[model samples]
Target: MNVLIIGGGGFIGSRLATEWLRQHPESKGKITLVDQAFLDIIKNNPGFECIAGDFSDPSLIDPLLEKKPELIFHLAAVVSGEAEKNFDLGMRVNLYGSQHLLEKCRQLAYCPKVVFASSCGIFGGDVNQVLTEETAPKPKSSYGTQKAMVDLLMNDFSRRGFVDARCLRLPTITVRPGKPNAATSSFLSSIIREPLNGKATSYPVAPSSPFWILSPKQVVRNFIHAAKLSAKDIGDDRTINLPGITVSVQEMIDSLEKVTHKGITDHISYEPDAFLQSIVLTWPPNFDTKKADALGFTADKNTTEIITNYIQEEHIQVPEK
Candidate 1:
């Protein structure tokens, strides 16, 4: 019952950890987390084993693999914006780091189950059509290319019985419960999050720009579901385009106003960044998640429910109506 999360310090990774523990109280100390750094809340906790270090380094991952955790959630990666800016860093962490980990697993020969956090950005380049698992990757940015590479590697490893792997092509997760980081899609969260906190924010794309999105809660739920699936369930194709809803930027803003009060989006501006748009604009917003749906993965009901969920989860007091 040993479990390990690679990027345990990040927002989604941390949420997964909290929910994992809550669901499986008996697995208290058996779950471990490896990351470059951690929040005080996660680091100072006595119930979980938090390994604060760069997992890309063989020194870090080597010892971790030695323990042979039965279920490994590989959520670590350089974000889209950061990776697009620094190709070397992206290759190091996103590609090579993962390469070494898989090599170690193959050497160790435990064949543990691995659930990877891949992205929809992998469906770039003239992708106006709905994406499915059979859609070949046409990554335009360095970030997408690197993530796509890892997905291929994991699939190959699984085919060869080196590891039982599932790569979930995650959509842009909305309403993240923190300050936006370097992800090109951070604006998706910022437009909703910053204004909800009575702060100002701007989206770098047009109001009509379409995006595939899911809630943080649903993303974590799918990750857990992926881990429980038997090898026969996944069969040949290990990649699953996780369920998500398609909505335009204007639709999101409209929902924010609906969930809270009017003028919530008034705090948002129209400043645009071509750099961010270049990456996101190329992503295919529509998806046919027949595989994920059949495999028991869930999707968010709508943008309104997503915003409401965030408010409840973060305990954000809204303006009185």
Candidate 2:
């Protein structure tokens, strides 16, 4: 089972590569890790091959299609903030780039199973208190709009028997390691992750601001589960919302306090940024993932568990007294 991860060098993508390699070492198949950066980070791992190229390049798709990987996980994207900032780049990479891949798959005589990593931002607005697979998407950001559009295309392609595709609407993955990126929600992970590591963090949203979240570990598991799911199980929709736990900014701070045992909570101060607030306020706070649950997809049982597991797995050292 040859697997190709389009953005394999990224946080969630890299984790998925590692997990798949660890679990399927004996399987006679190659795992190709493709990303424009972080090739060296994944180079040392056995059974791993790296392809450094831009997914937006039309030329890149032909070579990848020639490889004929049996499984493809399309995770490459410009992310939320960058997408909103660079509209043309966002459309080129997030929307058209995905279409390029799907077109290649459609041209193939033997189609592969494609697992697209979509975002919950597609739901949009605070009024929709609980999002479900049935909810009509109303994306507010270019990034969200692009993901939602690709999701519809995936369904249409699947119905046409071009490929076995499943779109997983991932929540805001929190407690991510490493320095922050362009995502507006990066602060959600940074506030807890950075402070726990004895670093300062800023809260860009109000303490009462609430949003749905999933840990990196849960996100990886959800991706693998999506890949393993049968097309018959997914039906004609071909998209499902992954489960997540919803909590407020204050709740996250309190959880950090409990785990770190330091009044690190004091290190956090709310100074709401209108730009980020506008984007965040439009995101759904919670979801009704009954369909996902029934389909055997799951997230962290609780927010506390999500935080603790991240601290443990990433080996982020606790602050000293």
Each model's TM-score?
A: 0.98, 0.97
For candidate 1, the 10 contiguous residues with the lowest summed lDDT are: 39-48
Error of 2 at 316 (Å): 1.5
Q: Candidate 2: where are CA atoms >4 Å away?
A: 27-29, 126-128
Model 2 has an lDDT value of 0.86
- Best candidate per lDDT, number? 1
lDDT of 2 by residue, 164-184 (tens): 999999889998888999997
Cα RMSD (Å) per model?
A: 1.0, 1.2
Model 1, position 301, has a per-residue lDDT of 94
Worst 10 residues of 2 by lDDT: 20-29
lDDT of 1 at 95: 93
lDDT of 2 at 284: 85
